[model samples]
Target: MQAPINIALVGNPNSGKSSLFNALTGLNQKVSNFPGVTVDKKTGIAHISPSLKANVIDLPGTYSLYPKSADEYVTYEVLINPANADKPDIILIIADASNLKRNLLFCSQIIDLKVPVIIALTMMDLARKKGVEIDLAGLERELGVPVVAINPRRNKGMAELKKNIELVVKEKHAPARDFIDSNVLAPDAIREIKTYFPSRSDYAALHVAVNSEELPFLNDGQKQGIKQALQEHHFNKTKVQAEEIMQRYARIKHIMKASVVETDPLQKQLRSEKIDDLLLHRFWGYAILLVVMFLLFQSIFWLASYPMDWIEGGFGALSGWLSQVLPDNKISDLFINGIIAGLGGIAVFVPQIMILFGLITVLEDTGYMSRISFLTDRLMRQVGLNGKSVMPLISGVACAVPAIMATRTIENRKERLITIMVTPLMSCSARLPIYTVMIALVIPDNRVLGILSLQGLVMMGLYLLGFFMAIFIAAIMKMLVKMKEKSYFIMELPVYRAPRWKNVGTTMVEKAKIFITDAGKVIMVISVILWFLASYGPSSKMDPVHEKYEKLIVEHPDQSEELNKAFQSEKLANSYAGILGHAIEPAIRPLGFDWKIGIALITSFAAREVFVGTMATLYSVGETPEDNDATLRQKMSAATWPDGRPVYDLATGLSLMLFYAFAMQCMSTLAIVKRETKSWKLPAVQFVYMTALAYICSFIAYILFK
Candidate 1:
């Protein structure tokens, strides 16, 4: 069997690169991290011919060879660093046909790297609609590479693309000549560098001279040698880069004139532009955005309620059945009270998670997500960030680990840091379970004006609160973190298209699966551990309760059921977990969190959603067999302190939700922050400040609501 051909799919942002990868690989893909970095690396297997398969790597989208952010650096490393393990055997550059001139500059640079290249021109339909025409044969002849027009979304041109891939591999097709002579920019430096790296082309060696310090693959000796050579030849790096870009554009202009034609250079606005006029209007845009957000939060509750009820009921029945059938042994208790209860807690939220991810996917597919950035740019600038930070902050609502990684697109260091520090304040999907459970507990389900759900309005308010607080924190950080580099926001708004229902469905399923597999594992393990702690204690403490309960049951045989309930409560208060929870109770008492809630707060640091599972487990451990039919929410609602005050009252629920919104609870997020900033200092400071903020906010919320 032949080893798979390594093919890297390179393209600019919004150039249909992701669509092409999905089309080619279908379900044969998996996402992992790039080697030694937190950036996502997507790779998959695509069959080019019956006898051959290609390992397709979807590298991060980048504009040019010059790298600024971490994401661009990953792409630059894979393409330019020969020692990179994932280096491609062939480069398939996906270029947007409608924006050919700008895309061509990147294409030309890749061509000069001497890799076998094939140009996949996407958005040709859009190009044609915009009065642009391209002669494919002429383009192929001019660029000295195979150029194939493809529409990956509709599966058009897949056969031709596959055929071209096969042919390119067979012939080892590379560009016939340099796109712009690199040696002309720095003749002496290029010549000297090539002698040291004889196998490299002049263009590749020139890059080494220019970016030696940034390139990770280069050894210290090579870097020093390259610097010495550049100095000896008096090679001006910035000037050479400028000259290279200018020269490439000069040639690209000639190519465009020869092979491409625009029917009207100044055509009327596109349909997208016409729509943007109304949708992007200053007054209407924000109103529309608010309405959109309101509907999104409302839908999460309204749509998922049926399935959530069904799931909750199913778990309740299952727990009841297990308690009755299982032999009342320790193992049975573990299954019923520990694993099953924990699984039930997290599993019930799957419907809501799917709804949230699915809606986010729709916004992205329709390109309205970019409009959001544009709409919020002014507000973002006021917070020391630009529109670039909005996407990451918005993404934080789904998950913070990837959201923090998305901050790589922000080039300004101080702005990026501020974005990272504040992003966790956004209530993420993990917190969705917390918010949903809490709101349903304390907030009324009644509709205001007989039309809008009060619960939904409160949900929206919580989300908005997080957003506003993020900006407020960003503003403060702006005043604190000192940096002089000017920040600017530049982005291209993609044309709106109908949401790809298939992609949206796929994302919904994938996110749900991730929630189950990744978070479920943690919840189940913690649930079992907590059950053990809550069920047993030091024999010295436990034996007294057992003796007291047994003696009382014998004395009052007629009221034995009531006595048993009292005994169960006494046992729980004396259990190992109870002692642990008690130790932290004083610190949290002002925030309305009892010892049980303290245990959850401590355990949920692993992940925010674990708070639900921890409560389920703790409550299950204390419940009598008759209470097994009750849901977790029911169990929590009935819970009370020794003084008889309900534990999950309005004040407690609100305080708990506030704490989660502000606190840095997820260890994974902290780890990613450390990796991204490449230091422990930032993450430590972030954890401290966020925790402090959470404590303060939670204390205030408890006081006001209590």
Candidate 2:
């Protein structure tokens, strides 16, 4: 048996490193958290040969070894610490072919670490299309490393790449160059800094001593040594280091010019910029974005309605059939009302969620999202956020849980916190069901402009309302929280390309599976518990009424069996759940919610989509003799309060929509926030603040409408 070799994949941002990893590993990968950190640790196994396999790790993308934030710290720590279980046997450095100068800086730093390194020239297809030509053998000789030009997207040159990895792993090949000492500072100063921080990687430590403003969690001796080094160098350390980076680039450019060729400059077009001019223009860009967003929301509601209705009706019929087939028993009731109804409720929205995420994935993959971020940067900065927040904010429309998690990429603490805080305000897919049901109930479905539905227009208004509120809240928080560090945004705008359907399909399937499986368990349990609560009553007080109703139904010679049974069930629910609903009626009356809506609200706290399921179960319990739409809707529409007032008027439906829009009704989101922030305090604060806001907003809306 051959021993497995360890390969580390390292690269700059947007260098196609991840795409290569996905290609090499191809479903053999697993994403796990690092031992003590929340940062994702992605690992996979690749078969190098029949007798040999290799372990591959995809390190986080960073420009340099010097770390500024937690995510970058993971890259630095993993490379520097050999004792880490997954330490690399060989480093595969991926460099963007189009930006060789910037990419080579990281390559130079990696080679200096004395690790066996291989350079994978990514984006070679783009480079070729741009009329850039390279003498691969001569370039390898100049860099003193084996280099392979790979177009990972096209699956070109992968066979050669894998063969090279095997040769290096089996010790059939040797590195083209050995480590050379290149001290960026005076020798004595470097020694002193090293003495104080013995375990720190030398090059990274030197970079930090020169560039970082303040080093947190450093000892007094280390700090003093760094300060002394800076003073003795008699130069601004950062400026000197920047000059060194520039010098390295100059050397790389000289080498490339000797060994590379440009066949035609015209072929190297600025297509990305041309597209951005229109897609991200100051005026047209934002207008296009708004129009696209409006269309997305409209499609989500309109396209999903047919499927959603089918799911609802099918589940209702299935439950009715099960109730009729099974013997009248508690177990049958649990299966029919608890498990089936609960699971169906959550599953009904899967189509809408999938469609929304699929569209987002397409937008992101095409590199259009970055342009939006670039265009929105100035506005976001004014609100104390970097343009990077734009992605999370937009993604919040699919779900806030992942959007909040995505904030981990933002380096600024204040900006990231504000992004996390305001993300939930963007209407997520979970809120869509509540919004759709309520809007359908209250808003007319007339068309405007001969194309747009009035319902769609209102939905668009609510989404925009959420977005503007996010900006306003972020601006206010910017004033409230102060930090001295000046921050700027820099991002890669990859050339536009058609979406990869394979990648999009994989992402959509994975995300949908996670949502259904993870949230499904909780929904099922809550449904069963709620079913029992609404079905069974206080035995001592309700048993007599139930028995009397049962006896009265038996004695009715003219009544059909189904009608009698429905009457008995309705009487039983009224005995317990109904009483509870009335108990809370006065408290909710000001918000225009009656007992049934209050019951749905209470049940939906576990998950927002439970509103539909709760209604199904409640109505199922109160089934009538005819059991037709006219009967059910009429009963629901005419449901009366103790004072004989109707339950679901336009004002009440509007209030419900507003309430769901603002409420922190998702347990999963709260859990994820706690996990991401690593504290109960943030999630707790969010729950309290959002719930209070929901109450106040709903209350005001209801009052004004009344």
Candidate 3:
């Protein structure tokens, strides 16, 4: 059996750290939560050689060893704690070749641990294209570590990287570097502390004496001992730590100057910067962003309709067949109405979700997302949020679960909290079905300026409404939650490169799979429950009516078969489900909702998309038509209230759409929030507030229109 060598991959954000991990591990990676924290832990297995298999751990991205947030703390803890199961036998410090100075800050800290460290110089191609020539041999000599250039996206230099890893493991070569020493304690105290510091520990005990306050798990005694040592040594730990970081950058710069060559001065001036000059311009940048968002909304609405129709049609056919084959019983009705209807509801929106995520992934892979952050920074600061909040806010449009998780990168406690609080307000793709159906029913299908559709304009308005609300809510929270830390925005903007299709596809597939599996189970269960409720009724009341209708059909032998079928439909619906619908009819009457619509709304609490599925099931249960459209749309159009008013009029549909837009209808989202916030209070508050707001908005819309 081969012994597994543990290798740690570390890098700055956007240094292709994730891409490199994906390339190394491929399908071998597993994503988990870092123990007791929401931060993601990614681990995988990579074969360095035929004889050498490695367990690779990809640490959270950090600029330096000095930690700021919980996510950043994970990076520091893993590096500092040798007892961690995932601790690396060899550390591969990855650096972007183009931004060597900034990337090397963390690299130098890793090297100081005296670990068997190697430099994986990523993005070397991008650096060379801009007239920058890195002398690999000279860089290796200066850093006293083997350096291998790799383009993880293209699988370039991977062979050389693997060869170096094999050699390092065989030779057990450790990089030599200057380590920090804090002589703050008395000689006797220093000797006592040294006993606890093992040779295998990466950093010296003195380094801990200086940096321990910045760590996450230090107790009172450990903190006091470190403080006393610093006091005795007459050292200001904060200043010393800052100096160490700055010195490392300076050293990296000096080494780069000696080992690297610049070829084309103008090559650095890429189209991205030129585009950013206008796109990130304080004035036009925001305007352009808004216009781009408008286009995205329009695209989503127009592109998703065909696939949605197909999904609706497919499920309608399945349910129709199931209703015919299953014995006329509650279980049959539950399968047709509940499970099929509910799953169909969410499945219909998959296309829209995929398209939206595809666009987002493209923007991120091509490095445009960083520019979005840069453009929004000043404006975001005014709202008491950091620019990093913009990414989460944008992601919220797809779903708030990932959006909330994405806030780990923001660093500021108050800002991250504010971001999470306001994120769900952004119109997620789950709400798209509701919006699209309503908008199509209410808004005119005319074209404005011979380009923009009127329906598209209304959709754009809803998206803008959500965005502005998030900003306003965040600003209000900023004033309410007072904190001492000054908000700062510092980010690395990667050079523009062609979007990597492989990366984008992988991300889209992974996200889609998670969304389907996570939410699918809940929706299916709710659908079945709803089906049962809607199918069965009080047998004493329903059986007599059902028997009478069957007797009438048998007596009217000359009557058309279609007429008998319609009579049977009326009698069956009048059963338990119909009576239940009538029972709740009074409550929803004010909102222009019939008992059937009420059932749909109640079922949709499992997920917003279930509304359509519920409607489809309810409509299909009544009678089968020639085709889905003729059956669904026509039946829906002909639906009437008790007073002979239309159930699904333009006004009621629009009101329903607005309701779903603002409602916290997703149980999965709430569960995720509970996990991420580590408290039921936050999600509880969110659910109550959003649900109340949605109810009020929907009620007003319905009343005013009626």
In order, what lDDT does every prediction score? 0.92, 0.76, 0.76
Model 3 bad stretches (over 4 Å): 177-192, 196-204, 211-235, 263-268, 315-343, 547-587, 624-635
Q: Which candidate is the best by TM-score?
A: 1
Give me the runs in candidate 1 sitting further than 4 Å from their true place.
none
- Sorted by TM-score (best first), the order is 1, 3, 2
| Cα TM-score of candidate 2 | 0.89
After TM-score superposition, what is the CA distance of residue 96 in candidate 1 from its true location, in Å?
0.6
Model 3, residue 611: displacement in angstroms? 2.8
Off by over 4 Å in 2: 1-3, 172-175, 178-180, 184-186, 189-240, 263-268, 554-583, 603-605, 622-646, 671-681
| Residue 264 of model 2, lDDT score | 88
**Displacement of the residue 19 alpha carbon in candidate 2, Å:** 1.6
lDDT of 2: 0.76
**TM-scores, one per candidate:** 0.98, 0.89, 0.90
On TM-score, the stronger of 1 and 3 is 1
TM-score of 3: 0.90
- Scored by Cα lDDT, where does model 1 land? 0.92
